[model samples]
Target: MFRGLSAFPLTPVDEDGVDLTAYAALVARLAGAGVDSIGALGSTGGYAYLTREQRARVAEAAVDAASGTPVMVGIGALRTRDVLALAEDAQNAGAAAVLLAPLTYQPLGDDEVFGLYEDVTHHLSVPLCVYDNPATTHVRFSDELHARIAALPHIGSVKIPGVPTGAEDRVAALRALLPASVALGVSGDWTAVRGLNSGCDVWYSVLGGTFPRTALALTRAAQSGHADHANDLSDALEPLWALFRRHGSLRVMAAAASHLGLTGEVNLPRPLRGLDAEQRREVVAVLDALGLDE
Candidate 1:
């Protein structure tokens, strides 16, 4: 199973579309920073915006970049058949695992939710992570239901999004209820300092995809019980995240990566827009102050 610090690497795009060279460079940087795995075509990758073929190219690029490290592909669709097809795609592509959320458009009952997972587990042999990104699905994961699903034969982990209200309590409950072997990860890098303090075992940090060395330093500090250092690093990021909070941030993050010389292509699809000039100024100032841009 993919564990420790992982990043959902954005798939780079340009006029030619799906910039493979840029995507590989992004993955190479993440791997060098010691990220455990690469998440391709997740929300960060604009999975909903990509065609099936583009998703395949992104997945192949990620696995190929890792060389030996495991790569995970996000299967973020509502239909059971389609998700299974994506899961099979991940398996064939040599991904370490598949990440998923509840059905889209319709609110699935807990039983139906469970059925989706059960069906997915049966259809695909690879280990899968239950992605409770209620921010995307518009339904929250209940503690009661989480306890019930921890024992399913094929589940390898659970990925709770960073936007969970009262996330401290949420992670605590998971620590209290879930089996020790079923790996638990938090996707909220903005509140990662607090999440680490809450005893969350895995930090699947999205911010690490930007300033990876700093992210690794923060993770190492947290792992070593050096909360003081970790908190300091988190403090350095407060301004950048504030800019991210100022706008619809799916594109802002990709832009932030670009401004740092990661890539100049911030090809965001519709329903999301790039950061305005003011927000970009704020990001640059914050990175400069942190010596991150240096």
Candidate 2:
């Protein structure tokens, strides 16, 4: 379940909270497209912003809409107790696994972060994926810290941040530290090809959530050892990647999903607005140019 394309869909929302119909459509689309797993409440899904009741509803909705595709729900929260509660909610909703980032307001030491995982993992019934997204979570996981966490029971995967050019050695070193049972997954939509070609086991993707076939093509190409094809596919999406770099992926993807009519115009949570009209026009132009508007 952890190995292949794990598509993280947006949790479409408005003033009414989660638009379960649209959210379910997104999950069902990815499932029909044959993604390896559906990641329901990752960063892309705006898990941090949703209430526990809302998150529980989202988890249940995702599993139900998955059509038997493995579903992994994000269970991150500020406190360890809340995290445990979220984990239970995910398990009760029938999640195959749970993704956890060290969501924090105060800066945390390595020991504190390690303790967080240790406490959560001790009571988790489902497998856990250690989400190492320092860019958002602000708590970076050193190789040693990762090794410690990966040793804990139920640590099925580690979703490492982007792999830069020529990062094979870095990936290899981390791989050597982890147990063979722990899959090394990659995040960062733009760097996924490089990560996969460098022997990462999975791509926990934002792109795949909305553009499953396109992302799947790239994923399959890399997994099949077709480096040239994978590189070409990634290169073709340079314009989209540029947009992602300019505006954060959450905003860009929200724009894409909105423009495509997959979700409502006011999809994002308050204070986090979607792209302005001008930027959205640019997104549309890029989509048309890339022949992705279809």
Candidate 3:
């Protein structure tokens, strides 16, 4: 069920609160675009910045807006208890699944990470996807830990961040260890095509959420064995991906959405600024080049 393009949309917000209207529009746009799944509150959604109440609202809006598309909510918290409560919220809000990251203030060993998933699995009625994003969580999952987590009851899939080096070999190694039933998804926009070719079953995509048509086209080309077409599409998206690498994707994406008038002025949480004038100009150039500014 968690295959193909799983669009991870940003939570459009202003000082007032989460912009459910814009948020719902974004979700509806993705669903109408034939995206395979919807993942609200993944890294791009700025899940970490919101309060529990805010997160609950976002999940509810996402599920309702998705209109029967499978909506997955990112349920990451520093505390396991908090994770459980968030998972319960996702369930109540009618999310299809919950994505759990081993978010920790201190480094967590494999045992601690495994215990976290084990506890969450017990509480959740829906399937869980293990989100292995070390960049935000500060905890990396080893192959052993991935296998152990996949073996747990109700555990469904794994969302892997891009493998910076030796992606094919590493993905192949993980695929070998994981059960055939377990789905493997790749995030990290730049490496998505490579990961899909390497054997990832799905993509947890940021770009796809904002611009579903482009991302879905690339995924379709790659999955259908059109390597040249897929590579060319990835190459075309490199400029936007470059901004994502330099300025951080969430900030840049919000700015892009606002520029396109897809969503009005996206207000991130305090202390984190959006793009500057120069960066905004660059985003405009990329969007125009991609014909996305219309």
Please identify model 2 stretches exceeding 4 Å from their true place: none
Please provide, for model 3 over 1-294, each residue's C-alpha lDDT reduced to its tens digit, 9 standing for 90 to 100.
Answer: 678899998887766778888889999989999899999998888888889999999999999989999999999999999999999999999999999888888888889999999999999899899999888888878899999999998888999988667879988898899888889999899988888877788989989878999899999887888878888999888888898999888888888888877787755765667888888898898888878753
- What C-alpha lDDT values do all the predictions have? 0.74, 0.94, 0.88
Q: lDDT score, residue 204, model 1?
A: 75
Estimate candidate 2's alpha-carbon lDDT, on a 0 to 1 scale. 0.94
TM-scores of the candidates are 0.92, 0.99, 0.97
lDDT of 2 by residue, 167-239 (tens): 6987899989999999999988998899999999999999999999999999999999998999999999999
TM-score, candidate 3, is 0.97
Error of 3 at 213 (Å): 0.3
Model 2 vs. true fold: TM:
0.99
Off by over 4 Å in 3: none
Models ranked on lDDT:
2, 3, 1
Instruction: Please write out the lDDT profile of model 1 over residues 19-40, one tens digit for every residue.
Output: 7788888888788777877777
Residue-level lDDT for 71 in candidate 3: 97
Q: Identify the runs in model 1 with alpha carbons over 4 angstroms from their true place.
A: 14-16, 163-169
Full candidate order by TM-score, most accurate first: 2, 3, 1
Worst 10 residues of 3 by lDDT: 264-273
**Which candidate leads in lDDT?**
2
Clashes of each: 0, 0, 0
